[model samples]
Target: MSILGSYLRLSAADLARAVEQPGWAEEFRDEQTEREELRAPSERRLHETGPAWDELAVLLGRCDLPADLVHGDRPLPGAEDWGYGPPRLLMPEQVAAVERRLADLPFDVLAAGLDPAELGDDDPHALDHLAAEYAALRTFLARTARYRHGLLVRYA
Candidate 1:
């Protein structure tokens, strides 16, 4: 859970840094110290701390955690159905709503939560006929067999 929390904050910081200098983001560039010191966001870059906090709330809400405690000060509702993508802008009220939902749930639940569909375990063989070829299916079956064996070894 701590790891997840730290990752969320780090992700927010990375976003802020990317916004400040989209180019220097991938590579270090010096800006100060009479020589371009690797251009990194200053501590002040955390000015968007509120937004960062809000992002966590949105994540918690999306995960279906209770959020009433963290965001009681704000009036937004918990987020729902956020899909796989980069972070999007969120209103402060929305952040508050997410906070409220998170506050009400166990931290582990919030940290581990994600839409179950995102964790699909559907058999690839279910659509084997659509492949128009057996080569792909053969490879899939081979991989699946190996995976199943691995599971058996670990669990049974």
Candidate 2:
């Protein structure tokens, strides 16, 4: 089974609701990805970053970026394991903090530390693809901060 990373932008209001009723975040993801039929996925923005996210997260930790940005500060209150466990919820503040950290960090230099052997897929271009996803994720978080939105990160 291939592990994949997914992210969904949540308005402040939606983030509040998700925190109050954690299960809502999963339902929201199902709705968004399904509604889009995943058409124009790039336009869907950072909706999915593939499995490279796992390795990327490790790299982030090595760079001293807070682990909560990807692994999350806490898991949503829910019983659903779904193979990869419950989704991670990052509040608007957490999102902003991550964006701020990304500001000075030359992500490419950090990304170079990623170990090819640790990648989920054996594709030779995995690192390059991960790099692109990293750039997109940074942009996505920046946009999320612009609107003061939070994020829901899920893996499956």
Candidate 3:
């Protein structure tokens, strides 16, 4: 099965409620369903515990960011009811910190050191594909920070 990553943007108040009330996420999901606003932007997909996801997790680990930000293949706390897993909540500050780390990352430098062959594909663009996904993640985190919104991310 393929594991996908996605995020939801939530207001501070809602985020607080989610932290305070374990059941808030269920209610939020239901309300979103009622309002017909449940769609989340598609992020990326990989094997739940596969190399591609592991590689990204390793790189993120090197950056010394919060563990929750790049948690791999695990359901977040309280996300089980959503039928995926628990979602990782990135507060505005956490988003800003992650964005800063992403901005400082030298993609070309990292790419140069990566062996595409080890990525398990002969496709010449495997590194590019990973880079694009990383960029997308950065953009999402940055947007969440800029808007003072919390980010709810999950791998499912």
Winner by lDDT: 2
| lDDT of candidate 1 at residue 112, scale 0 to 100 | 58
**TM-score of every candidate:** 0.23, 0.81, 0.68
Whole-model lDDT for model 3 versus the true structure?
0.61
- lDDT of each residue in 96-142, candidate 2, tens digit only: 88889887777677766576667656889877777787787787778
| Models sorted by TM-score, best on top | 2, 3, 1
Clashes (backbone N, CA, C under 3 Å), per candidate, total 12, 0, 3
TM-score of 3: 0.68
- Against the unseen true structure, what C-alpha lDDT does each candidate score? 0.28, 0.74, 0.61
Candidate 3 per-residue C-alpha lDDT over 17-129 given as tens digits, one digit per residue, 9 for 90 to 100: 87777577656754653554344443221112333554566456555664356652233355554535576666767767777777777667556667877656688887787
The candidate, 1 or 3, that scores higher on lDDT is: 3
Q: In candidate 3, where is summed lDDT lowest over 10 consecutive residues?
A: 42-51
For model 1, how does the per-residue alpha-carbon lDDT over 31-83 read when each residue is reduced to its tens digit?
Answer: 32223234343211111112223333444344553223113222112322122
lDDT measured at residue 45 in model 2 versus the true structure, 0 to 100: 29
Q: Model 2 scores what on Cα lDDT?
A: 0.74
Worst 10 residues of 1 by lDDT: 147-156
